[model samples]
Target: MEEFSVRHRRFVANYFAGKVKELRFQLAIVVAGCDKSLSTFTSGGEVSRDNHQAVLYGFSAFTNVIQTLKDAVKTVTNEQLDWSKIERLRHGSFMRNVRNAATHDGNPVISGWADGRYFVPSKIVRIDGFGKTIEIPAPAEDVRAICLDFAEDFCLLLRETLIAAGGIEHLKGSKFSIEEVEDAFANSTFIPPFAKELFAQNREKIEADLKDLKHDPIADAVKELGEVIQYCDSVKGD
Candidate 1:
């Protein structure tokens, strides 16, 4: 069997980094969706189908994030991800169960209750899977809180796992020579030869764009993790 080379390991690290970036974007979507759902419920006294669909979309996106992280870890470390080992999921597979019930099963039963002068919407998700039924409270806030906590913990877990696999050295190597980037774009099948020619014709613009593009993967991950922690803490305080 061929041994996985350092280059291969670096590639895996890069892939993991890319997925982490995607997770940040998806998490933002999840938060926005939850906020929209809550706002709709607050104004209309119930979440409309369109607003509920946004919530479902957010949940589905989260599930995809989990699967992608698992794939990244497995590909990089040659080890299967133990979801139970994740701190958030240790108590139960709440995320997966809720996602399955909400998206795969029929519409999630959205019920509300009176809290003093305020009416709070509770998302009740029932599924036979995991041998239990899960009720998410004030899903707009509750579900978002759950996802935030999970995301923070999961990001930490991924950092540790990737570090153990090998330091994410390549993640820090974001800057590439213009020639190298151009060569990649030129060779990419997605970019037609004509496009490559156009790219060449606009090399100055491309170089300027590349120069203006400042990205630090590790910094970005840390910033997102911090935001997740802040949001989780705020929810807990609430």
Candidate 2:
């Protein structure tokens, strides 16, 4: 197996950092879909559709973050990464269950609204490797709260895992910032060699425009996470 390099670790970590922001954005849409405030303007069908779509996209992004973290950590460790060993998932992991259901069949049912409460349905029950069955609750709000907690915990876990994966020293000495990395990626253009001559006249303008674009991945991630946390905390228990 090839040894992990600082650049590879950085790339994976930055990719996930950006994904966290996107996951938060999707969750925001899910929250809006369930908000009673929207009842005045939006029809039940529209709200339901929006909620379902948000959950599908959010859960899918969460799963990707988990898998990407595990894969990156495995690159640094000689032993294979084990989901069962993770402390966060020991109780019950809806992230994986939700992701599988959404990817394989269809989105989990986000219906059932009464007394200003939303009830979601999980078609398949999850069984762990140890023969223990884990049941995820169907309340849409509860699921969203759990997802927030999961995202926060996973971010910390990723930092720790990466440190353990021989990147700790590299990180300590690293000068790279998330904003700088994102900016570099934004400015990178992949023009095909065959098209180089066709667009040669506008190459200077393209390069100039790319350089003028600014990206702040960390700021965006933090803002989105804040929105999700505030929304999760504001909802009174049902």
Overall lDDT per candidate, in order of appearance: 0.59, 0.51
Q: Which ten residues in a row have the lowest lDDT in candidate 2?
A: 166-175
TM-score computed on alpha carbons, candidate 2? 0.53
Q: What would the per-residue lDDT of candidate 1 be over residues 75-189, giving only the tens digit for each residue?
A: 5566666766763552135554554555556544323323211122655546565667766444343556667767767776766665565444444543565787788987799
lDDT of 2 by residue, 142-162 (tens): 445555566555555544554
Per-residue error (Å), model 2, residue 94? 2.4
Worst 10 residues of 1 by lDDT: 111-120
Count of clashing pairs, candidate 2: 0
Candidate 1 global CA lDDT score = 0.59
Q: Which portions of model 1 miss their true places by more than 4 Å? A: 1-5, 43-46, 77-80, 87-92, 96-142, 163-223, 234-238
